[model samples]
Target: MAEINVTPFVDVMLVLLIIFMVTAPLLASGVPVDLPDSRANPIDQQPDQVTISIDPTGTIFIGNERVETGGLPDALAAIDRGQAGNEPVIVLRGDRTLQYARVMAVMGELNRAGFSSISLVTNSSQSAP
Candidate 1:
């Protein structure tokens, strides 16, 4: 009787699992934003939610595509139309180093675009105390 070698297969599987675990978070958001720390609980992310990322330099991105400040409403409108009847939720990820006014400007644009369900993304607070 011949026995299958399970040890080598298990080693390969463990290595692949470790690689995925390390890369999963990095792949989560294409646009990297240094989010501010918050004590608030994290919200469940819906698959169809629209993400708007603002980098440290104040450049805005809708998904992975860059959009001008003036063009934000139009971009969001396009996304809204593609969602059929389901209401679109906008997730804003602004860098921590950005000024409050810059962040507010983006929010104001979303508000003007008639997107009510907006959530700000922040990193969970890590305190030693």
Candidate 2:
């Protein structure tokens, strides 16, 4: 009767840890995108970077925010100006089901916004040696 039972405490802690482990990865993935596989080596992720995602429908999203098609240029320009002098890398992710033209158009807009440090995100099919 004097002994303390710690079984309940350990069970609760284990459950919480498992929940966090399952959800942590989902947070970094952001929007759902079926990225195309590439054999090229993966690049190092930048500390200061912007994520632009284009879904299978060709809809564009800046980070998690959705922007109008006509407003993409201005949106990108605003981000560019907001950064002052620091040139942040732009990571573009387009669904593999999308047309090449759509991706090119987004790239063109990025270029127009004076962002030269742009990178394309792709799922690597093979590990780089």
lDDT of 2 by residue, 8-109 (tens): 999999999999999997897678999998887779887778999999999999999888979998899778444567789999999999999999999999
Task: Kindly list the per-residue Cα lDDT of model 1 for residues 16-102, writing each as its tens digit.
Answer: 999999999899899989999888788999987899999999999999899986787788778754555667789999999999999
Cα error of candidate 2 at position 100, Å: 0.8
True-vs-predicted CA distance for residue 118, candidate 2, Å: 1.2
Report the number of the highest-TM-score candidate: 1
Worst 10 residues of 2 by lDDT: 77-86
Q: What is the lDDT of candidate 2?
A: 0.89
Q: Among all windows of ten consecutive residues in candidate 1, which has the lowest summed lDDT? A: 79-88
Residue pair clashes in candidate 1: none
- RMSD in angstroms, candidate 2? 2.9
User: RMSD, each candidate, Å?
Assistant: 2.2, 2.9
Question: What would the TM-score be for candidate 1 when compared with the true structure?
Answer: 0.90
**Model 1, which residues run further than 4 Å from truth?**
81-85, 127-129
